[model samples]
Target: MNETKLHDLIEKMTLEEKAAQMSQVVSSFIHKGSSDEKITGPFAGMEVANEDMTGSGSVLGATGADNLRTIQKAYLERSRLGIPLLFMADVIHGYKTVFPVPLALGCTWDPKAVEESAAIAAKESAAAGLHVTFSPMVDLVRDPRWGRVMESTGEDPYLNGVLARALVRGYQGDDLKNDQSKLAACVKHFAAYGAPEGGRDYNTVDMSRRQLMEYYLPAYEAALDEGAELVMTAFNTVEGIPATSNKWLMRDLLRKEMGFDGVLISDWGAVQEAIPHGVAADNRDAALKAVTAGLDIEMMTPCYVQHLKTLVEENVISEALLDEAVLRILKLKNKLGLFENPYRGADTELEETVMLSETHRKAARETAAKSCVLLKNEGVLPLRKSQNVALIGPFAESTDLMGPWSIFGEEKDVVSVRTGMTEKLDTEPAVEKGCDIEAVLPEQLEAAVEAAKQAEVVVLALGEHSEMSGEAGSRTNIKLPDAQLQLVAEVKKLGKPLVTVLFNGRPLDLHGVVDESNAVLEAWYPGTEAGHAVADLLFGDTNPSGKLTMSFPHNVGQVPVYYNSFNTGRPKDQIDPEDRFASKYLDAPNGPLFPFGFGLSYTTFTYSSLALSSEVMEENGTIRVSVNVQNTGAVAGEETVQMYVRDLVGEVVRPVKELKGFSKIHLEPGETKQVVFEVDEESLKYHHSDLTYTCDAGEFIVSVGPDSRNTEEGRFSYSPAGRSGQE
Candidate 1:
């Protein structure tokens, strides 16, 4: 299955046969499930017959070793060239032993944990016979109204880029050809799919090319640099062109510039969507455009199967282009070792042993514990086992902790809050459902109050339902539901110590809950071990170390708030503190409710003595910055030390602050440590207004601290090569 063999196979393929290799269909089309199919998005009204799909090179949504084996065997028998079908699925966060959603995992800021979670997912998926996973969706998102934010790693390009590399390493492992607990990683929704207009899904994205490169494209490039084998096209339009067939995006930026020579697949039905997107006249034109534009696979659509061969025959598109696409597919198959063992990692016995094994669940629990961010703590947490606790709310005993994109996770296997507490506390906590997610009956409210009266402390479990924040789950109002808010208000009247634990997908506006509760914990939809992880954190068994990767807006009006914001002409940090002409919000602060890199821990850390290696740096030379941090409180905890840089003067305006580096370190009481950061030419480079990637000679400021808002600062001058404009 080397290059010689792959070339021979492609040469033997007929035009129709090569076209079939570029088509993909859902598993349901081959093995119909026993239920009324739900067609949610652009995939509705699409149909594929067994005759049309038998030769398809790949199948989506097919799971289980037994099912995949059957489907793959049937496909190879009719494949004409004996090519095995590639089984792919959306193993976004987890496959069976579901972990916290990507957004929640991002809060951990622990690349090791993020990588371990993906490794667990890879093991489970590989045992189920999946060869490729449409995952590590490294889209940088700032707007919470976009339902797909749950699938992203949050807004910062640097953070998203770092996590993107971790995920690819975990999924692909050190060697994809040799690792059985691995799957080919497919970094998805290529080229700025996260920033839709008004935070709406699939809306147009209008931005300058420099903005796209500076803010959006870095994550995808990072994933490719990590050796991801495939890339999936975005469903939205980029610069007035549908991403599925945009030549500038697919060719100039992605291929020629970024040097990504991997396979490119369209998101579900995106090729056919080109017609509705107004770029193509019909299916034939859509197929031609996508193929010529560098797309190698058409997912869940008949556009390629029906028209690709005809387009080639009519000389509308080059036959060599079709062969190139077919060759890429064959090369991937060979790399997977599918040419030797068609059933590469499929083993029914191994599947049962590894799907939800105790070892895997332990990793999930540990990761979930690290992901829970302590938003506000008024000395009410670290609950004593002797106290009588009341666990009240809809999620008290509910097992639906796994959020969207957990396609294979079964609710019956999940542990509930009550179950988790029972295992940790000496006395069984009183549990009562105060209300549904969106409604509170009068009787339910009374029962909750009675339970609170009987207990020494009350723990309120609350959040959006699992269906509220995934694909197409956008919400105009990002506040807690009225029912949950009303329940909090009623419980606050009892004057009992209140601890609120939230389990939503996106960053929510927590004005009501934060005001009512003495403590708040953002426990975003922790998967299989949701209850256990929450219990561990509550009982002082584990320290909360998670920091926010995405900014929590003060309200819905500040939709795209983040740590890195351009310094506008009317600066908010003006010379005159009371200046009314500055850019300021009358009703709310310009910053987020919780800024990026912000989190509270059980212990406190103090920073002092910022030092720099030099006052001036020459081009191509590195500058070292150092700070002293000490844990002053009487407890052990972890702290994320963040570093920010600002170009005081630039050719074009720059953000007030940009996060360049960060480190997560553990400290015991009275422990002191020195944290150092190095800055070089790459750290200073940015996309200029004229689209040139360069760094200007100017004064630069560096800050280091616990978060972006509070930091100790120092300044230096940077001079580029052969430029003496700045002294």
Candidate 2:
């Protein structure tokens, strides 16, 4: 929207109208299984749930298409300023055409696919009548023990930033005012919500300013740069105050410095919870604090509707501060074309036409298949297509295979592994109830043993349930939840070739599984078509090439470890056969079980020596780095050609290596493709000590790889002229 139009809308709002903009609707994850779900959290200020939500409205789940129409109509007609409400829903994995969870999508490491998924989600949710989606969670999660990691993209900020822009672009599209698209994308948990102490939900986050800027804050900035219309505050506190009321974080840092002029929404009553954090006296005070602190929209909290008017009339909050929030909201509505047409994007045909079409399902299937990372394979994978496969585990036929935060996404509609296998097979293989991975039953165990004894190959399905890892479901131990470890050990003792497929949300401590299973696939809640996708890989119909978006720690104590960590002053001797105090762990290795960008295929690929156009290129000069990749394995497969850059010299300490770019490619056996990456000056830019992004003349290492660790050795220097793509 133009500034003049925004200014006009701002001029038109009354005091009450201004207060209404400070509020928004919510759709909580909570459900009673029978009654209409209640909008929980701080929204008690509301009189009741209604079709028209003006005083910081709340969306409770996917209200039917008709109900959404009613809600939109009521808001457009009854609102004091004629401002349309922002209808929101947790369209996390998928709105209707479910795909892999965020953690699994990260494994794909294909930004185009990631962006496409978000775009598909935007199309479906907008069709269903939502104006916003609280998604593309960009928190830098390191601890797999934290359940919310399932919601984040991954651990690396660079990758997160890239994905953030993709999600934002996909969600908002070219223009939010346009019809047939979803609402504004919300990049969440404003600051360091992932680095919580003890990996607990809503725990305190304490870190250096450098860590915040260099790591956690980049994705938020990227989202803003991509024109994301909204930003949601985190539930956790940074330094001391909860992020919702953090002036330094919300105003000084995000607004003033970052120049984000979008509405700031609080996460599910986070504003009022500050009272418990000793930051506010009560809900009334919380309302006063949040708006003044720069949170324009109280997400679930009716803190504003219940108390902000009183606060403003009492002169506790300046009228100007309240107007600031109203102006932002008005600008958003105007941008959404709500002020002009209110129902600009609503379409009955599009809603029914594309919400669950075969095209979307096919995309979901491909995405789900690509997101599975083959963690362990000793040539036992790529099972014969004609073999009689035994699919074992409690969840082999699970109706709730999709992970947490799903919008009532169904399992029956989702193609199960058992079902997918049958559809793909020329002959129907014997399917048996081989005992529940979680359920402890001697009879089922004996039956499973007997089944495994007869089959040539076993596809053991095991992992957390759909509800086990998101939001309020943090875990103390990231290992497989049930006695699945014992079960795997028990099954392995029989020693028939086994391929274990994991259905988890967060990174699990697979120490036991790794040791016993012949081949392992991290198939993190692969949405609706998960079963079919898994079957495709197992039956050798498709080769798995999904890389780990996040680090898989060897153990839980190695929490917070990621690839971009700075080199310690006293570095560990990674090559030492025998050394003490080398910064190496006594019980385990110094690296993750699965590093970022690490994935395996049924086939192998060879990385050629790095060839640069010029090893000594000037900073402004364009240098092309090329590497020839050969598919050495017999089967045809896709490989993610990754590029990592290192500024050997910097004003301050820098990461050992950082992901610059990546591309996905498919190659037949023995086929070679020369891939090229252009690195000018922008790829070498970094924030200086004075807090300005600068490109320095320095030596750099351009590591080409199938994954982070698997790279050819190379050295190059980038001499500065001036950086393009600078902010």
Q: How many residue pairs clash in each candidate?
A: 0, 10
lDDT of 2 by residue, 1-727 (tens): 5768677766786666666667655432121121223233444544325322344433545444555666566555655655566567677778878888888888887778888888888888777676778887889888888888998889888788888888787787786776458668878989888889888988888887777887789888888898888788999888788899898898999999999988888888687788889999988888877887899887655577777777878888788888777777777767777666665555677878887689988888898888999999988888877777777787777766678877646666788778887786666655655555456677777777777887888878888886678887788888885577767877898888988999998988898898898999899999988888998888778789899988889888887778887777667754465767577678887788889889999889998868988887784687888999999989899999999999876888888889988888999999999999988777887777777776777788988998887788578876555632222
Task: Residues 587-622, candidate 1: write the lDDT tens digits.
Answer: 888999999888898889999999999988897898
Best by the lDDT measure: 1
Superposed by TM-score, candidate 2 places the C-alpha of residue 34 at a distance from the truth, in angstroms, of: 15
Count of backbone collisions in candidate 2: 10
Give the runs in model 1 whose Cα sits over 4 Å from its true position. 30-43, 47-51, 575-578, 725-727
Worst 10 residues of 2 by lDDT: 29-38
Q: Clashing residue pairs in candidate 2, if any?
A: 23-56, 24-56, 24-57, 25-57, 25-58, 26-58, 26-59, 27-59, 179-345, 619-719
Residue ranges of candidate 2 with Cα displaced over 4 Å: 1-14, 25-62, 75-81, 344-349, 433-437, 574-577, 718-727
Candidate 1, lDDT over the whole model: 0.88
TM-score to native of every candidate shown: 0.97, 0.92
